[model samples]
Each structure stands twice: as structure tokens, then as C-alpha cells.
Target: MSGQPNRKFDLALTGRRGGNVWTIDGEPYPDANPLSVQPGDHVRVHMVNHSPVVHPMHLHGHFFQVGDAVQDTVLVPQHMGEVTFDFIADNPGDWLFHCHNLYHLDAGMARVITYVQ
Candidate 1:
């Protein structure tokens, strides 16, 4: 396990059928509030999938520890299933977090993790 997460966020992964729009925490991509942290902070994200399809959640610029392994992405299954992972925010910048599915990414299943100054 990496550094223990001091900051935590719970996100709800959702989607709209008719329009094929994807969302995180009820907000779509650009509209979703960025997860903010400071350098050296350990962060954990609890992701809950509410949609009917699977979403491979990817994080840029950081690899997170889930259980015994470290990875940059993890698959989140449908039907309200959840996954939790933690990462150290040692990099200072705006990093993207999104669904690996190209269609879902295009549909707005994304947000940013920002390192505060």
C-alpha cells in the first residue's frame, strides 16, 4: 500500500440513455467540480457505478493503489458496484480522470484532480 489517503472523495458514475451522456457525481465532464488537493497529500476516490454498463476509470499523471497493486486505471462495473483506490498527490498540476471508453469519455464522463498552489 502507498501512503494512506488523507483526503477522500466519493463519486457517483451515472449515464443518460436517450442522449448517451455520461456523468460523474451527477455532473458531466467540464461541469463536474475538480477534486482539489495539495502536494504530498494522499487521496482516495470511492467510485460507485450507477449505470448499466462498465466503465474503466483512468487517471492521468498518477498511479493509484487498489488493494495489493498499483494501477493507473481500474474497471468499474455496473449496477451500483463500487471500487476504492488511493494515490499520493505528489505531482502538482491539473490531471484528468475519465472513463477509458472513448464513447463514454466523449459523452462527458470526466473530471480533473487539481493540485492547489
Candidate 2:
């Protein structure tokens, strides 16, 4: 086993009418909960739309790549597709991840990701 640890974390978010209910390891993170991350880690966000409609996802501060070095404001089509994106946790800060729907944000469909020092 390598002394240096390579960690992979999966974040699952559900898209609904109001907002997203996020679960990390099957537990809900309360509103305004501090999102802590570490450097040299890989993050995989598996966004699933449980709603009858579609939602577009965005990750702020960190421009991510999906299969290639392309900027994506991806729309998760209803009941069909799941958009997956990965990023290297290089920058450290409180970053926002949420749906691009204005009303959805108004409805509280947002969360913060914080990289610890």
C-alpha cells in the first residue's frame, strides 16, 4: 500500500422543484453547513435529477472539465441522463455549487464547498 493516500469522494445531489437535497455518504448536510475540502484530492459529483423536470448545474470559482477541457453549463435531462464532472482540489475557498435556475436558487437549491487550509 502507498504511504501517500489517494482519496476519491462522491457527492450526490437531487434536483427537485424547490432546491437540491444533498447527501454525502447518505446523510443530509444542514443549510449553511461548512463544506470542507482538502488539497491533492479528486472530487466526483454525480448529479441525479429525481424531479419531473430538468436542471442545469454549475460549479463556481473552479472551472471543471467533463471528459475534456470544455466549460459546461450542463443540463441534466429529465429522468434520463446524469452529468458527471471531476476536478482537482487545487484552489482553497468556499465555492458554490448549484442549479443555474434563478428561481431554484431563490428556492434555496444551493450549497457551498470549502477547502480547508
Candidate 3:
């Protein structure tokens, strides 16, 4: 879309009894999917909920606009809600992105997106 490369990616958040688990690129995240990016690249995160409960996604250090929230947290309803977020990989470093629920993070529903040199 913009000057940066427009890449489409989908992440799934599955709800469990107490928390949720996340998957990226068809693999279990954190231990499996390590986000890789380059400077100027535009990434579109299409977060889909596969579980029966709602999940609020959050990204640290970067402010994203999904609807109107200036902060990072966004509410995604169960099994049907999907949030589309775009960001320019200008900051070259590793940034954490995941569900806002602390229990979800403990349940492996978190990941780090890295912008390379």
C-alpha cells in the first residue's frame, strides 16, 4: 500500500479454560514464530480469534490505531472479531505484541516482533 512493502499476515488466538494461546504462520508462537521485519516495511497484523471468548490485543512501545484507541490495547470479540493493525517498521529493535490479559501472556499468547537493520 504505502511506500513500504504491504505484507498480509494472520495470527490466531485460541481461548483455553483460563487463558489463550496464539499461533503465527501456522505454528505455535513465541517458541515457533519469531516476527522478522526490515526498516520501512509495512506490516498488517490481522488478528483473528479462534476461541469462544474475547481477547484484547496489545502492542508495546508502539501506538496503533484500530478504531480510536491511541494506546495499544484493542478489544476483539470471540470467534468472529478480527482486528487489522498496520505499522511501519521504522524502529529497529524487538518489540513485544500480544493479548493484554496477563494470564494470556503466561499461557504463551505473546510474541516479539523484530525490525532488523
Candidate 4:
């Protein structure tokens, strides 16, 4: 996001054995570690996938600019693949950001974006 995002987050996606925990930034789901933002804030998420599997990242409550298109979900290929998306935090609430893959999500890959006052 060369437009200079007001809020920036770097997320890394990976998987851990023994419970098959799908992790974001190296932690399981219900991480309780939310990304805080304000309404109208320009947010950018730079995501990198370290696993050898594709991940379709989804953001609830807002559409994001990926490449030249605006969509809520974008795919990040495996093996160090990266994706950068930008969005305006217009919705006010706690939204989930996670992999669209039901299995990965059920395993533990997710985060909450909390809109703070």
C-alpha cells in the first residue's frame, strides 16, 4: 500500500502439528490479540504465508483493495507467498479476519479487528 496506510499490520500464516493448529503470526485462534483501528482509518495488512498450502484470506465487514480489484477475500499462495491489501475501516465493531478455508479456520487461523473509539 504505497498510499501510506493509517494503520499497518504484518501477518504471517503457518501451520503447526499436534492439534493441527493453523496460526497467524505464530499463534492459535481466539488469539484474543486483536488489531485495533478507528472508523475511516486506512488500514493495510501485509500477509505472508510460510506454509505449503494456499490460503484464501477473508475479512469480515469491509472490502479491501487487492491489486486493482476491490474484494473482501484474496488468495495468498503457499511457500512464502505474500499479499497486501488495503481497506477503509468504515464498519464499527469487532470483525473476524481469517482464512476462508473452513478447515484451516477451525484449526486456529483467525484474528479479530476491533474498532476502537
Candidate 5:
């Protein structure tokens, strides 16, 4: 990660919606599982959108590198479009990762990023 040797991880996720219920990897809201990593570890998440609506993916509390830009949010086009972002877990805490669309978030497309010691 940027030539700094520490720790790293990779994750894959999928976005889907059904009957007003939006989900990440088939689980909705608080029910969706967290991706566990430690402080200072580099984490990469690749998201695939299978839903009909576009998802502006967001990560709380930390900025991530997506393509050539560093951003807190990235847009994943619908219908199999995919996006990959990487970040160093400098802020150690539980955080939310989800779609930024109000309706989509309210409909339950969210997951937690749990930082473990």
C-alpha cells in the first residue's frame, strides 16, 4: 500500500434490491455483516451493482482511493457495473458503508466496517 508495508485485505460485495428492500450481499441494514480489519491495514472493496438503480457508494469517516481520485463516495452504475476502492484503516472504529441514495439507504442497503484490534 503506497510502498508502506503493513497489512492488507480484499473484499467483494454486491448490491441488490427487491420489493423496496435494498441489500448488500443479500442482507439488509443492521443485518448485513461487517468487514473486519485492524487499524492501519489497507483494505480494498470491490462492489458489483446488480440492482436497477445506480448506487453512489459511500464510506463513513475515511476517504478512499478510487481510480485516480481519492473520495469518500464513488458511483457504481447499475446492472452489473462494478467499482473498486482502497483505503487505509487509519481511523479505528465501527463505520457504515452503504449506498448514498436516500431511498436506497432508507430501504436498507448498508453494512458495517468493524475495526478490530
Candidate 6:
């Protein structure tokens, strides 16, 4: 956990009513832009939830500091204006970041964080 981030990302979480689709920053999983970082970079993510359901966002391979706590998963309440967190990119690999809700995950609410040399 660090006070300043070398890179930052702003994401909007949304879902289509009655449709089997979910999106992040207007793009569905496998299509969402990959978050790229160097191994030592400090990263920050700002998320806004527009859907009507809570989204427990999970990140694999890294734990982020939210306020005073560190966690791998954070609950983004429905209609929340924003939530932000930061993490150090110590792991050098492609990692998954997604909504933990199974249906949402299956519906394409996911993206990848890639660490590059």
C-alpha cells in the first residue's frame, strides 16, 4: 500500500436490465481495456457503480488498501457514486479483476491487469 499511485484507472460498473450482459467502463469482459503496469508501480482504481445490485469486486494476486484496510475484494454498493483503492504491483503476471457475483462474472463483468517488463 502506498500514498501515491504511478497509474490510476477509473471504471464504471453497469449491467443491462433483463439482458445477460454486464460491463466495465462500457466494455464487456474479454474486451475491456487491460490495465498495464510495471512491477513496482503503485496503482489506484476508482470505481463507480451504476447498476441496481451490489457488486463485490475481486482482484486476483494483489490486495488493495481501501482507507485503513487492505483487501482483495470490496463491495461496491448499488448506485454508489464512487469507491477508490490502491495497490502496489509487486506481482508480475496477468491477473483477473471481476465482479464476484457469479451471474455478473458470467455476464462479462471482468477485466485483466497485466504487468509488463
Residue pairs clashing, model 6:
none
Model 4 earns a TM-score of: 0.93
Task: Give the TM-score comparing model 2 with the true structure, all chains together.
Answer: 0.71
With candidate 1 superimposed using the best TM-score fit, by how many Å does residue 52's alpha carbon deviate from the native?
0.3
Q: What TM-score, over all chains together, does every model reach?
A: 0.93, 0.71, 0.80, 0.93, 0.86, 0.94
lDDT of 6 by residue, 8-68 (tens): 9999999856769998987988877898999889899999999888889999999999999
Backbone clash pairs for candidate 5 read none
After superposing candidate 2, which stretches have Cα over 4 Å from the reference?
1-35
Residue 106's lDDT in candidate 4: 92
- Full ranking by TM-score: 6, 1, 4, 5, 3, 2
In model 1, the worst 10-residue window by lDDT is 16-25
What residue pairs are clashing in model 2?
A: none
- lDDT of every predicted structure (CA atoms): 0.90, 0.61, 0.70, 0.90, 0.78, 0.90
* Model 4 Cα lDDT, one tens digit per residue, 1-117: 356898999999998444478989987789649999999899999999988889999999999998789999999999999999999989999999999988899988999999998
lDDT of 5 at 95: 93
Worst 10 residues of 3 by lDDT: 18-27
What value does the lDDT take at residue 55 in candidate 4?
93
Expressed as tens digits, the lDDT of each residue in 62-110 for candidate 2 is 7666666556467767665677767667888778776687666545556
The model with the greater TM-score, 3 or 6, is 6
- Displacement of residue 5 (Cα, Å) in model 2 is 11
**Per-candidate RMSD, Å:** 1.4, 4.8, 2.8, 1.8, 2.6, 1.2
TM-score of candidate 3 versus the correct structure, residues matched by position = 0.80
Clashing pairs in 1: none
Over 24-87, each residue of candidate 3 has an lDDT whose tens digit, in order, gives 3335556866677887777778887877777788887677655444557888788667888777
**Model 1, global lDDT:** 0.90
